[model samples]
Target: VPRDIASRQAKNMCDEGRGVGPAIKERDPNGNERMMRRGVYLDFSEAIGRLGRDAVSARYGNLFEMYQRITGDDPYEVPMRIYPAVHYTMGGLWVDYDLESNVPGLYIAGEANFSDHGANRLGASALMQGLADGYFVLPDTMNDYLADMLRLGKVDPNAPEIAEAKRSVEERVARLMALRGSRSVDDFHMALGRIMWEYCGMERRDAGLRDAIKQIRALKEEFWRDARITGQADELNQALEKAGRLLDFFELAELMCIDALHRRESCGGHFRAESQTPEGEALRHDDEFLYVAAWEWGGENRPPILHKEDLVYKDIELKQRSYK
Candidate 1:
């Protein structure tokens, strides 16, 4: 409902100028600063007082294990170091009204497509949309698309283009194996993860995003040059599979920064610090950025080309939202 920007607000609170942590130091009626750490103090001791240890364990079994792992402190004794992180990505492959991607015959559904959530995702609604796609939408839409395909007849497996594509994949895997470097694939992955966490995590600014793009490009170069993987590709090779997945993540991370850099307006999860209000709320430039950004791969080592789909609302009228 709040356009999914609470994570940004949390990061903003920990900024250099306003390192307030989780506490809200609001002035009381008597003019004294009243510190309120909302959701900061999940008092296990209090909860245990109301409901015994067995009840607490039953209620928060997962969190209890997490508390032991993270801090090794009893949940009843100390509050967990709660922090916001990059959890669900509200973006993915672009899809049309029929949930079909630009690529012919390819259909995206649920979390695989970016159609449902937009730049923001609300809790219950997000799940509902995915359910709707699965049960109601995709069935009818896929049938419509498949009906046309039926007329075209069963596809030839030995088609030239299909064989070429298969060969391309084989060549890519062989290349990765042959061009083995000193550093392990895990090392590069960890480095890439750190870079993304530091520069492109919950909070993003222009300088950091720019630096991220540069760093990602450099890391991507080093990744291609110095990634190592053990074992043969034909066998059940987990490392090879991981390395391949990581290859996509590297490119995706770079494109993420590029897209972040391109969109100057602060809206929802894609918050640009330069476009936020003084009070730190995201400032949406609807006039300028009311469109979906789609990026296409433009060959190896080339920047992705962005194509926009204009958003035209038929039911809802545009209005500025404010919450105080």
Candidate 2:
């Protein structure tokens, strides 16, 4: 089975209240420790017996060691308790053919840019993407922008626009530092993670997504009101950095939910509950949603604007994927 299918199946079992093994405990965003269901079983005992422990150890010695270290379970004798978690970020900031974003002079490359993968990225593709983008694509394309920049002369650091940008950063940092609340940044982060994973993880529905947006907004408000940062802006503060990043994470989470709400069809890793076949297979609607949803941020008060980039295939034809 594909990674997406495996994840969906695991989540399905958990959702249906048939999850096995001891409940794994983790701290939720609300500062409470919750026991999450583990629905997947990874049995290595049969493999260990068939291939011999030495052969299996030779193949996955490091992984086995790491797993044992974390869980204190011996895979050689017992089946490993497992569940799918987030591995890679398939999509990121939108970029053009030259790897340039809408903002001039900013060139995005590798995992930071959304170009190569569509809805889902296969295993080991991130490495291939990083190597291609870093070694080949950005090197050649960045030169085009650099040459243009050279023609325009040097930019002044003391410019009004530059000063305003600097001021904005300082102000934001000051606001973060000024928080005297009892809750740590991690509290808010954990809460936000819970919201996203619950509503927008393996599968999604209209009601859940709408409810998620509201919950996320409420949490974001709570974060702004109560999040505590320990250090000043001038010093190297990991907590402050986390606080800032968590703010962005909140925004990104909302955007993801909004995007999920808009695209009602199940495609790639995004499995909409309302858009599946009788056999529980993902149904892709190629006619209505065969374009890239390039969302433009519409400020704090307004909703985001969706810009569609139609996908055109000349050499290859688009077809529904089957894992039957």
Candidate 3:
């Protein structure tokens, strides 16, 4: 089965209380382990027995060693516990044919640009794209851009816009350091992750997305007002860096929920519960949502504006994909 189908199945198994394991509860990145179900087992005992231990070792010895080091379980003897977690994200900043974003001078390549894969990315394709982008595409396209830059001449570092941008960053750091509240950055981050995982991961719904947005706003307020930073901003401070990243994460997470809510159709990895086929397959509304949603960030106290770039297919025909 595909990773998406398998992941959903695993989630369903756990949700139905049919997941098997030691029922261990450990708290870390996976959220409150006590409240969440343990993962499904990836047993290899049968495989080892069938193929012989020697053959299995030859094929997967290094991977088994890594797994044993992490989980402290010998996969040769026992089943390994596994769960669905975020790995590869299919979409990113929109880019044109030359790999230039809407932002004129800025160019994106590799996984950062959402120009290659349509929705669900095929396995091992990203590596090829990444290679092509670095070794071939950028070398050719960037020359044209750089030639234009030569005509424009050198840019002054002391420009007003640059100073304002620097000031904005400094002010954000100052605000974070000024917080007198007690909660750590990790505390708020874990809470935010839990909310997103529950409401926006794997499956989504209209009501749940709305609720998530509300919860995220409340969390953001609490985070800004209360999240504590342990060290000075000028010196080496991991906590301070984390706090800054978390602030961005809060904004991005809220935006993600909003995007998911508005899209309304199930496409690729984004599976909306309200949009599905009679057989529980993803139901895509190509007519209504056949465009890239490019969101413009509105300033404080303003709503984000949606810019649609319609996808026009010319060379090939569109058809529903079947794995059966």
The TM-score leader among the candidates is 2
For candidate 1, lDDT tens digit of each residue in 157-241? 9999899999999998998887578988887777777677666776678898888888777877887798888899899988898
lDDT of 3 by residue, 29-77 (tens): 2344654466899888888879999999999999999999998999989
Clashing pairs in 2: 29-190, 29-191
Off by over 4 Å in 2: 15-18, 24-34, 44-76
lDDT winner, 1 or 2: 2
Best by lDDT: 2
Instruction: After the best TM-score superposition of candidate 2, give how far the Cα of residue 125 lies from its true spot, in angstroms.
Output: 1.9
Over 4 Å off, model 1: 1-77, 314-321
* Model 3 lDDT on a 0 to 1 scale: 0.82
List, residue by residue over 1-324, the lDDT tens digit for candidate 2.
666777788877875757787777876444577676766687887888789999999999898888899989887777777777976555778898888899997888767777885345665676677788889888899998888878888889999999999999989988888998889998788788888888898889999999999989898898878878897678899999999899889889999999999999998778899998876778989889988899999998689999998988889988777777
The residue pairs that clash in candidate 3, if any, are: none
The lDDT per prediction is: 0.76, 0.83, 0.82
Give the C-alpha lDDT of model 1: 0.76
Deviation (Å) of 309 in candidate 1: 2.2
The stretch of ten residues in a row with the least summed lDDT in candidate 2 is: 117-126
